[model samples]
Target: EDKVVQSPLSLVVHEGDTVTLNCSYEVTNFRSLLWYKQEKKAPTFLFMLTSSGIEKKSGRLSSILDKKELFSILNITATQTGDSAVYLCGAGGTSYGKLTFGQGTILTVHP
Candidate 1:
């Protein structure tokens, strides 16, 4: 069975603050680590990491996976109120469409 856990179930930050979200997992035949952000509607894709150490980025958001450690971290720098959302982490296995997800971390950014 695959299992994912995210730390600090919720966070409160002000604009311009930097935040790091943690995710740890134990997955059988792990293929990749996936990150998502959910606001008012459906969740939006953030990053998918297959290789360890290398970081992926988009604007102020970035993420890195550590395969050996079986963990990943999502970073948001200079956060804005618009950045407030529920961050979700998932572990992807060899099977497509099969993922074990963590109970998201809710980030509330204040102006």
Candidate 2:
């Protein structure tokens, strides 16, 4: 069965602390790995890493993909209270945007 798993299911960090969220997966016909931030409602997109674009970065957030390892990592540098949210990782395959999501990593940034 295709699945994704994230480590450190929850985290608490002081302002300016750096944190890394881990996601590992097992799937067939893998196409891409996507990252999202969830606060309420549905998750919002953060990064999408494919064979052509294996690394993505935005501000203090960055993610890298390792197809061989079948996993990805999200790094947040200098986190702020505003950064507190649930981090979600998903795999995109031939299912046409159908995503297999990991149990999100909840992040709480204390000021």
Candidate 3:
């Protein structure tokens, strides 16, 4: 059974505090790992790490993949209240964009 698990299902951080979100998985044939931020209806893509691109960074957010370890991590630096959102991790297989997701980590940034 393919599955993804994230730690500290919920977190509270003060402004400017750095936070790290962890995602671990077990799958049949892992093709890639995807990170998303969920604020409303659906999650929005943040990073997609494959064998070719194992690390991705954008602004205050960054993520890395470990194919051998079968897990990934998301790091947020200089957090802000606006950064409060649910973080989701998904595993992508060879079937196009087909992904199995984790329950999600709810992050709250307090000002």
Q: Which candidate is the best by lDDT?
A: 1
How would the candidate models be sorted by lDDT, starting from the highest?
1, 2, 3
Question: Measured by TM-score, how close is model 2 to the native structure?
Answer: 0.95
Which lDDT tens digits does candidate 2 get at residues 1-111?
A: 899999989999999999999999897889889999998778899999987435688999999998888889999999999899999999978887788999999999999
lDDT of each: 0.96, 0.91, 0.89
| lDDT (tens digit, per residue) of candidate 1 on 38-84 | 99999999999999999999999999999999999999999999999
lDDT of 2: 0.91
Clashing pairs in 3: none
lDDT of 3 by residue, 84-111 (tens): 9999999977776788999999999999
Whole-model lDDT, model 1: 0.96
Ranking by TM-score: 1, 2, 3
For every model shown, what is its TM-score relative to the native structure? 0.98, 0.95, 0.94
- Report RMSD for candidate 1: 0.6
Candidate 1 wrongly placed segments (more than 4 Å): none
Candidate 1 colliding pairs: none
